[model samples]
Target: MQKLIRRREANPGVDWAEGGLHPLLARVYTGRGVAAPDELELGLGHLVLPDKLLHADRAAILLADALAADKHILIVGDYDADGATSTALAVSVLRDFGCRHVSYLVPNRFEYGYGLTPEIVELAITNGSPDIIVTVDNGISSIEGVAAARDAGIRTLITDHHLAGTTLPDAEVIVNPNQPGCEFPSKNLAGVGVIFYIMLALRAELRRRDWFAGRKEPNLSQYADLVALGTVADVVPLDRNNRILVAAGLQRIRKSQARPGIMALLEVASRSPHNVVASDLGFAVGPRINAAGRLDDISVGIECLLQHDHAAARALAAELHQKNQDRRLIEADMQQQALQLLDQITVETESAPVAMTLYQPDWHQGVIGILASRIKDRLHRPTIAFADGDAGEIKGSARSIPGIHIRDILDAVATRHPGMILKFGGHAMAAGLSIPRDAYAAFHDAFVAEVELHAEEVMLQAVIESDGELAPDDFNLELASALRFAGPWGQHFPEPVFDGVFDIINQRLVGEKHLKLVLSHPDSAQLLDVIAFNIDPQEWPNQTLSRVHLAYRLDVNEFRGRRSVQLVAEHLSAAE
Candidate 1:
């Protein structure tokens, strides 16, 4: 698919340069809607007060009561990275606060699907027989599951960050920022962030009750590491509050103050804790833990996070690392198959469909989300990939582009054509659903029509937003290093990317698929190192092209203790 490198519009209201920011960075920050200098402050004090989160205090009261009464507490967690981190954070903190009977159960995706399903509730009862069920990272839509727990005489507290459906679950307390009537300023809290806030509120409740007079109080900041990992892994918007959480977590991880599990995972992923950043957590550490949930069982991930011993955590990290490797292989095979299907479909149509729905009976259920995401990025269309589910149904993982809310589309489909979609829930960019296998054609048509109705024609095309071009002097190492750390950037708050034309002094293939090149700008004679990962093998090494336009990020490449400026290419094409 073709891509357009468009520069972001500068925000005229904010003057970051006057606020003591680097001129180049000032422009970049202002372009991202930084209205004031204080917005860049990522301290813990800048985080939104926990009191503002709806039902958080109520949930805290329930947890404090459970702790004081020595009630058995069972945590129901989802099976992804966010769920694993949320469960580990909740279990670790509650235990640290002296809850002896607290334990967690993450439903296997293969057996019970998602959320606090009735089956999961029964499993929790058979296993832990708890007095209170605390759901972390999920349960916003588990209406029947909460009812089942209630019937079994167990109270439930739901802490989640997913967008709530029209009918909320009947849990005893719900602490989601996105829930109706909530006043939490930042609605983009990831599941782990929500639970962390609840724990913070719980600590305050315990403090108010004078429960910490004799017992040592746990520093909630210690769990910020977990919050950071989950928040980034889940790809939530990095608003001011989330940035604080992630920054604090990165600080702890860099200082080696994080838990053994995180350190062990970083070690296995060859990421030194001293230089860890949000992207490392997103691409490296998060994936290893998520691999267990995707391929085998998420308990391995939860257990890894819960480990206090370095050796034990390392063992589990190694196992998770293997799972991640297996998951990559599976994802690669599935992506190839999906692309082939897309090719056939394209040949039969005048233009690619505005939305895509793909199904293959043999596709791995665990890898469909990634496949959907890959296809969505490749074609710049809303894409859903389905894998065979139980009996006559198929499960799909959907990924969407900007300006197209996937969950809303799914909701519309469900509303317009009842029973076409069995169930669905998620955020703007991603969602999951199930439907009858026989309804694939009809659902595909309905989904495409919905997307066409809601999405603008411009959004259907791939547009790579850049921070414009860099000046000759701006391409130095000092600026590159500054830009690298200027952000714990991800999702809504993007890392800076720039577009410019460059003369290709050298070009070759590295690692078979990656393109490595030495290039010089027309305005400067100094050559810079550049590399583009996962480039098309057939198109690259084009000795035919001497000049090219590149959309790239200024990156600092460190090789054997030597650091230099490097350009990480986002998009490259022949310069007209």
Candidate 2:
């Protein structure tokens, strides 16, 4: 059973309802730590300055010197959407700033693995023979890769956002908000955001040097859309600083001021840039870009983002769309098989699960992370899913509930059982690990014990938090549209969900899986349309239903140029 609780509210020092905020949304923002009306200001001017990030100015100087000296610059990027966007942003901004010879390389997850491996360095040497190498979204733990680059006489600068390990890399300069001693207010910048800041500082440095004496400095604000895409796709917390970046970026996308590549991606997904939301970035475009890196090289994704021609970008976007479809098919099959495995485990245990570690030799490594996340959501427990790695080893991806710090759990398990875990690193919610295939038993036991030790029994139980029932005044389209544009919601700052009893007027299935219903409001004569995607037939009957409390968010669904308010139902239970 799932428990529902209303979030606690805080005073934001104003009459929010009277200050142009919908009453429903005022409480929602207040619950999320907003203290005043100005906190919701998402204008670009409200963004935290780049200089607050440590080493940002130094990184700028390094890049400016390279451009002035006509040195070849190579960007080493990880194979993910954040890395793809970072590389694309760097390449685009550098070229625009008169850096004539600049290129990028992303390690193939299958061959070179992640980060700047020695093998990747060798490949980079053979391909570009760069004078300086810039690492984007990776290289925080790449001790050997930096060494290899140094040995090959290449200067290296590291710009990343991941938490650092015990020892830092020996790069010439490092700029990570999470790095030790950095007082950047927002440590939540995605890899792409970090690189974009560096670009901003680099532009300032160039201006200070009078490098643009005769030529105009390209406006770097044009790249904020890509920054927003990567920030949302990377799933970093939407702190106020990050919200500013995303809000500014969304404004550009909505204004059709986004780049050709971003525009093409929106086209392929059948999304209007004018109406694009943060969810669209994370769910639609992110997956398509990530699909290329997961199943193939990320060059295709980077090329798509870097392409200036609309037609060429569309061609690449189409290719990415096909890859995303293929990825979803693989993910669905794996999920089904995993559920079957879970059934066997449940049968053996006959008790509620606290945690789970599942492995299938044939499972795709690229997809295991997504699978782990799914299992964690369903079971409401810390979950680790392993895909076959090198011979005698497995690559495990983990996801955790709110109360459990997954990375700490892994560290403790590894500490207790040395060599049981070969290698691991990640943040609080997610992490990656490697272990011998034969060590699955020990790994599973250790993980379960650690999860139980760290999390309370109540946390293990499935619980859903609601923003409470909506008032009669909240049922209008004006309120729905206002709520939608309240702010760019993500991660820590969640979209609002409210519960209310509704009488089902008409119900039908759409696309063979979705439950589409017309609901009547409890306190009014208004009829609301709702769609619950991928709901089980058993959970929702074909017969018309009445008096069910629905936890849903307000949505605006458009069809054939006609726009109407729609309720996107998340959970439904019999009204008490």
Candidate 3:
């Protein structure tokens, strides 16, 4: 069972209220570390300066010089949504800047894996012997690839956001916000955001040279939509700086001034661009673009975003939509199989480990990350799911609870047992590694031991933090709508979820594992609509209980031209 802990909601927001923030918004903002009302003003003017990033200005000078010399710039991108959008943004923006020699190549994940690998560099060379290589969203950890590029007489500029390794790449210029000496306050920039900053710096460099003297200077804000899409899709924390970037992009999408590819994606997802929100990017748009990379080539997604023709964009978006559906079906089957495997292991012991690991040779390598995430959520433990990799190695994707630093655990395991982990890279909560097939047992033991060394009792249990029950006055369509569209919420800046006790007036199973119910306040006669998805049927069978406590978010459900406030119950517990 999950534990629900009420957040200590603060009401001492006099300064915030004086700054013209709504009273409710003030408390909500303060609860989430927002001290002043001005902090919530996510305008383009609020963005952090690009020069603050270490070496960013230098990187900009290098790129500007390359462009001035009319050097062939081949973009090397990772095969993911962030990489795809970053690649598209680079290609589109460079072309808009009147550079005809700009192009991109996203490595086939199955063949080349991630980053600008030596093989990928050769493939890039085979495709075209570009004079310069501009890596978007990758290449920070590519020690060999950078060397290979240099040997081939190609200059390199890497604009990545992933954490840098102990040793940096030998590139012409590196513009990662998370690099060792970077004092960039907002280090959580997505790859797209990093490139966007580089673009900003490049524009300043060009302006210094009077490059726009005879040409129309491209307003880079036009690419903000791509930045927003990639930022949200990558699930990066929406700091004040990231929020400004995302909000600017969201404004463009709402105004129907989004790129043709984004419009096409919205169309396929059945979302109106006029009403698109940040959540739509994560749940709807990101998945479709990711499907191409997971199931096929990421080039499809990049090409879809690059197309200026509305019809062509729509057609590619439709194909991408179908691929997403196929991905979902495959993911469902894999999840079920994973659960079965877990059952077999825990069935005998009747208990699960603090660190769980599973391997399936037939699993699709591209989908293992999502699979690991799902299983981690289910078990409420650090989990790793493995798939077959090239050679005799098995690639593993890992996901962890907030308390467990998965990448650290991998490093520890590798240190404790040498020649075990061939290679690994990732952030705090998610990571990827490869191990020899014959050493799976040793690797699993080392990994689990490291997790046990780090797992605390509090970390092992799942705790759902919630804002205490909303008053009847707070439960209205206005508040719901305001909360939904007031600003871009993601990662650290979460949408509000309130907890309360309600009388179960009526309940019925709608779709598989979903419950539709009519809920009523215990002391009020007013009725409310509630939809609980993926709820275990055994937990709310026939709704025999008269009342129950629920942790839910206020959602605005719209149909046709009508809209209503609905409660989306995320968690439930017995009433006190």
- Native-to-model Cα distance after best TM-score fit, residue 381 in candidate 3, in Å: 1.2
Per-residue alpha-carbon lDDT of model 3 for 438-506, expressed as tens digits?
999888888889999998887877767776678887778889888888768898888877888898889
Better of 2 and 3 by lDDT: 2
Q: In terms of TM-score, which candidate is stronger, 1 or 3?
A: 1
Evaluate model 3: give its lDDT: 0.87
Model 1, residue 313: C-alpha shift (Å):
1.0
Output the worst ten-in-a-row residue range by lDDT, candidate 3.
Answer: 343-352
Q: Which candidate, 1 or 3, would have the higher lDDT against the true structure?
A: 1
- What TM-score does model 1 achieve against the real structure? 0.98
Predictions in order: lDDT: 0.92, 0.88, 0.87
Q: Candidate 1's residue-wise lDDT over 1-576, tens digit each?
A: 568889999887775656778878888898888888888889898889999999899999999999999999999999999999999999999999999999999989988999999998899888868999999999999999999999999999999999988898888999999999999999999999999999999999999999889889998999999999999999999988899999999999989999999999999999889988899999999999889998979999999999999999999999999999999999999998888987876632226778888899999999899999998888888999999998999999999999999999999999999999998899999999999999999999999999989978788779899999998888888898889888889989999999999999999999989999999989998898999999988899899999999999999999999999999999999999
Clashes of each: 0, 0, 0
Clashing pairs in 1: none
Clashes of 2: 0
Cα deviation at 290, candidate 1, in Å, is 1.0
